[model samples]
Target: MTLSNLNGVPGREDAVREYVQQQLGGLVDDLRVDALGNLIAFRAGRDAPNGKVKERVMLSAHMDEIGFLVRYIDERGFLRLQPLGGFDPRNLFARNVTVQTRGGTLPGVLTPGGRPIHISNPEDRSKVPELRAFFVDLGLDAAAVRQQVRVGDMVTLDQQARRMGDLVVGKALDDRASVFMQLEVLRQLTGPPRHDLYAVFSTQEEVGLRGAVTAAYSVQPTIGIGLDVTLAVDTPGVEADEAVTRMGEGIGIKVYDSSMISTRWLVDEFVDLAEQAGVAYQLEVLSQGGTDGAAIQGSRSGVPTLTLSLPTRYIHSVTEAVHVSDLEAGVALLLAYLK
Candidate 1:
């Protein structure tokens, strides 16, 4: 929940990184932040044959969330934004937001630049606004706004994560939940892993997997595992077939997505491991979207990769939810594999 609440957009992940670093202290043998702000932590493998080389396994979960940068501030103290990642405009209506400026954070309201429904024409009310039509109201005079806010300051939606029945709902869970799972796996390790682990808390994944691309190149892992959230559209409106994975059923072992197909052997291995360990698991095939796994898989000559996905609902929106049982299953499966 703390990971989800921390504000970190594509190129700005300092707060999230700092928090993760603090949690990871003494858990791993080595830790460093890369040039692109990806936090890499290394833990060596247990005893192996003197001449044998242990495989390097990279586990990546991004820290950044979809947000906006202050693009243009108008004379009336209204601020225009440039979105850093994918955002459904419908979710942007009258949202509480925070503008992180050089001096400090400012509270603001994010709304479209248009008339309210009471006075809007039927045609106007029927139309959905584009991202360009949105603006932030800082409730400050132009001079005061200009004195604090800048063109490139970060702006993030505000939402505190909370437990709802069997699910945890909040903003930024698309990948933060996975980040939390990775940290738990680290904490639960009873001994050195079977393979050398390079846990990467990546940045800029919401934009284009930018941080993972460079980190993968640097680490050059022999095997890669991406920890991310997958769509769980098992709501009332969506078809059963379209529900990529259902909440509380299990963690997803990715089989296919638009970015990259899971390495066949790795997928089979995890499946077998899950079955042997009696961990609930499901096969996922998403029609669209990608994760850091794609970047690591295609890194050099191509290392084998598979993603472990937590089924999530309402991704890219403030009310993103993940089942607690599913999170437990994911951690258990990863621990079983690493052991």
Candidate 2:
């Protein structure tokens, strides 16, 4: 929940990195931040066979969420934005947002510049506004706004994580939930893993797999595992077949997505491990979307890679939700594989 609440957008991940670093104290043998702001932590293998080199395993979860930057501030104090990642315009209506400037954060309201429904024509009401039509209102005079805010300051949606029945609902859970799972796996380690682990809290994943691309090149892991959230569109309006994975059913073992297919052998291995350990898991095939696994798998001569996905609903929106049992199952499966 803390991880989800921290604000970090593409190319701006300091707050999230700092929090993760604090949580990792003494849990890892070595830790460092890369040039691209990816937080890399290493734990040496303890159970490697005598006279045999240990395999390097890379586990990555991104810290950045989809957000916007202050692109143009008008004379009247209305701030225009440049979006950083994919956003559904329908969800951007009248949202509470925070503008992080050099001095401090400012509260604001995000809405498209248009007439309200009461004053709007039928045609205007029927049309959804484009992303560029949106602006932030700070409720301050132009002079006051320009004195504080800048063109490149970060702007993020506001939402606090909360428990809803068996689910955890909050903003930025697309990957933060996976980040939490990775942290839990580290805390649960009683001894060194079977393989050398390189846990990477990556950045700029919402824009592209930018951080993972460089980190994978540096680590050059023999095996790669991406921690991310997958779609769980099991709502009333969606078809059953379109539901990639169902909430509370289990964690997802990725089989296919547009970015990269899971390495066949690695997928089989994880499935076998899950079955042996009695950990609930679902095989996922998403028609679109990608994760850090694609970047790692495509690095160098291509290391084998698979992504462990948490079932999530309403991804890319503030209400992104993940099932608690699914998160536990992910941690369990990871421990079984690494131990």
Candidate 3:
């Protein structure tokens, strides 16, 4: 839920990983990271029946989101940035942002690189700002700004989390919500899964699904489930057909996405379980965006894979919204799947 807090916190993924580790420390059998920097945690399965090598279950939630870095410092103490992820130009005016410097955090607002409004023309106003046209003002001189912020300083939006009834509204929830869900499942597991369970918190999903490629190769799970958030376009502007899913609905069973096509048999089994358990659920066919399952499914010999997603709204924005009830359903469905 610390989307704003995590923005611009690129490569500082270890900090988030450490936070998760501390949160689940005593409960997990082991907690560590793969060479590619994914947060890997192990919760041994209930004393493997007959002492067999337990089957593995890989769970992943991306810890990264779009953000920016300090690209240039201007004479007037303004800061230029290089975007780390896709950013919409329409939403880049006078918005508060965080300049995460090496020394300390400095708060600032983003505005286009331009002259005073007194001399600006109507056409200039019509021209929506470009990502390159924006600059962050940290309220400091050029030398002081340079001293505090480095070339690659992380910068995230300042829209802190807000409560929307039982739902949570914040940035980076695109997948952290799933990260929380995974831990909650482990908390409820009480024992190991039917097979070996490997909870893998992946990295660089927004960029290229990099962490999972290495992780899938290493873990080799027979079945992989990418736990993440999916678009729930229940709001205005989007037509019913254009919307991928809806709010307050159950977990999304990914049939296919740009990255991979989940096995037909596995998808059917998930639906069956959801129905039998009376858990609210729905089918999904994402137009784009992929999860860790894709990477794992193709790794090595090939493994059956699927995505278990929490229905989220305003994805990739400073405020990703998800109903609390839906999040709970996602956890329950995963538990049912594991059993």
Q: Show how many residue pairs clash in every candidate, following the order shown.
A: 0, 0, 5
lDDT per residue as tens, model 1, 1-339: 888899999999999999999999889999999999999999999876789778999999999999999999998989999999999999999999999999999999999998999899999999999999999998999999999999999999999999999999999998999999999999998789999999999999999999999999999999999999999999998889999999999999999999989999999999999999999999999999999999999999999999999999999999999999999999999999887
Clashing pairs in 3: 8-155, 45-192, 46-192, 55-196, 56-196
Winner on lDDT (1 vs 3): 1
lDDT of 2 by residue, 1-339 (tens): 898999988998889999999999999999999999999999998766789878999999999999999999998999999999999999999999999999989999999988998899999999999999999999999999999999999999999999999999998998999999999999997789999999999999999999999999999999999999999999999889999999998989999999989999999999999999999999999999999999999999999999999999999999999999999999999999988
* Stronger candidate by lDDT (2 vs 3): 2
* Clashing residue pairs found in predicted model 2: none
Root-mean-square deviation of candidate 2 = 1.0
**Which lDDT values do the candidates have, in the order given?**
0.96, 0.96, 0.81
Task: Give the deviation of candidate 3 from the true structure as CA RMSD.
Answer: 2.3
TM-score of each: 0.98, 0.99, 0.93
lDDT of 3 at 270: 92
Candidate 3 lDDT for residue 267: 92
